[model samples]
Target: MLYAGTRHRDYTLRVPLAGDLVDAQEAHPQGLVRLVALDLYRRQLLQLGEIPAEAITLELLRSELTEIDMAELERADAELGKRFAPPRPGSSTGAASSTPSSVTATPSPTSGA
Candidate 1:
């Protein structure tokens, strides 16, 4: 339920309150603020306006975390890492690629009889 906005004045990102988010809240109280930075890279929830992570209040987190959907939280956690994943080759858009192509392998030659 917690959200953020970019300085560009384009959109806002909604924080999906999943297990990790709750765990982070319990672990350090201010941990969710860090995750907010990650969410910015992912462009996860673009709606609110433009706000900085340091400005995101813990009180809001406490009030809103429970309201998040359980299923969405699971999805958000699973997809979190994808935010930093590299873009596909020949892709012009800066958006994250649905297809993962971070690595490629080459076959080695073998001796023939």
Candidate 2:
């Protein structure tokens, strides 16, 4: 569990345990730290002693965590989502849109019709 404030207030996190690291490694080979931390915290906690795991939500994590830490976490979460995310069929790996808006198909003049 990690204490958030300078004075180590009640708001805390119990994220990124051994299993979480193993799972992240299995899913994302490169293992970007902040990105994985965000994801794991969503699952593990926003603990204040005995806070239930179900209490974890993106909104709560953002609101509960220290402002300084959330800034970095948010940036990491938003940067290059595909880098940590599993690729789907026809999905672009890059951060930008790869799909062209207007593709045209023209039959070759050499075609014997």
Candidate 3:
């Protein structure tokens, strides 16, 4: 999911685990692997000091977890995700588009009367 920060910049944070991570395995064949994966993700986030310990519970961690602590966490996560994940399809990689519309274009210079 993408988060907009205080600076009004859009940042994307991608959770790495794929749907196959939840596939039934001999050790954990009940399809609980996704839960385990989420736990690990939450622990990693906590280790990074992103979300507080109180926010690390299974319920809170499993649910959509954009909390008050997410501003900085989202920023950091976005940076990390950018470094790790491939650029999203059709996403701009360079500086954000700052071009003004044609309606706001400056008038061209003309010869003095």
Candidate 4:
């Protein structure tokens, strides 16, 4: 598990491991540290026949998280949701609408009618 923090941005990435810890000594010393860490973690997981890489994502990580880390993660997720949730249709405060408005249309007249 890895926790990454950014200014005004909350992003969580989680990868499940079922095997030995991966050695990161051979990873690149500079640039793309997060991707490298993920690759290393994934390699270790694969060696142990754990979950697939495709199963990992920010959303899944937020859900499966546990412990003190979970509290922090949830807070970050809530913040992110507030920041990125779609704007409501008619709410003045930008809050999401609970019920969507129904749409009704009258039938159009035909040319041969």
Cα lDDT listed for each candidate: 0.39, 0.45, 0.40, 0.36
lDDT of 1 by residue, 1-113 (tens): 33442222232333344554555445565645645433332334333234454544445434343322323333443454455456679878666558865221111122100
Error of 3 at 69 (Å): 0.7
Cα lDDT of model 2 by residue, 1-104, tens digit: 23233222233333235686566556656757755665565643344334455655555554556655455333433432433346898976667567653211
**Looking at model 1, which ten-residue stretch has the lowest summed lDDT?**
104-113
Candidate 4 has its poorest 10 consecutive residues by lDDT at: 104-113
TM-score of every model?
Answer: 0.27, 0.31, 0.28, 0.25
Clashes of each: 7, 0, 0, 0
Question: What ranking emerges by lDDT with the best candidate at the front?
Answer: 2, 3, 1, 4
Clashing pairs in 1: 5-49, 5-50, 12-45, 12-46, 12-47, 13-45, 14-45
| Cα lDDT tens digits for candidate 4, 3-44 | 233111122223323231234434445526544444443342
lDDT of 3 by residue, 1-113 (tens): 11122211222223444442343233345546555654434433423223444644546544544443344444454555556567799988897569642211111122100
Residue pairs with colliding backbones in model 2 are none
Best by TM-score: 2
Q: After superposing candidate 1 on the true structure, give the runs of residues whose Cα lies further than 4 Å from its correct spot.
A: 2-49, 69-71, 81-113
For candidate 4, give the lDDT of residue 84. Answer: 49
lDDT of 4 at 22: 35
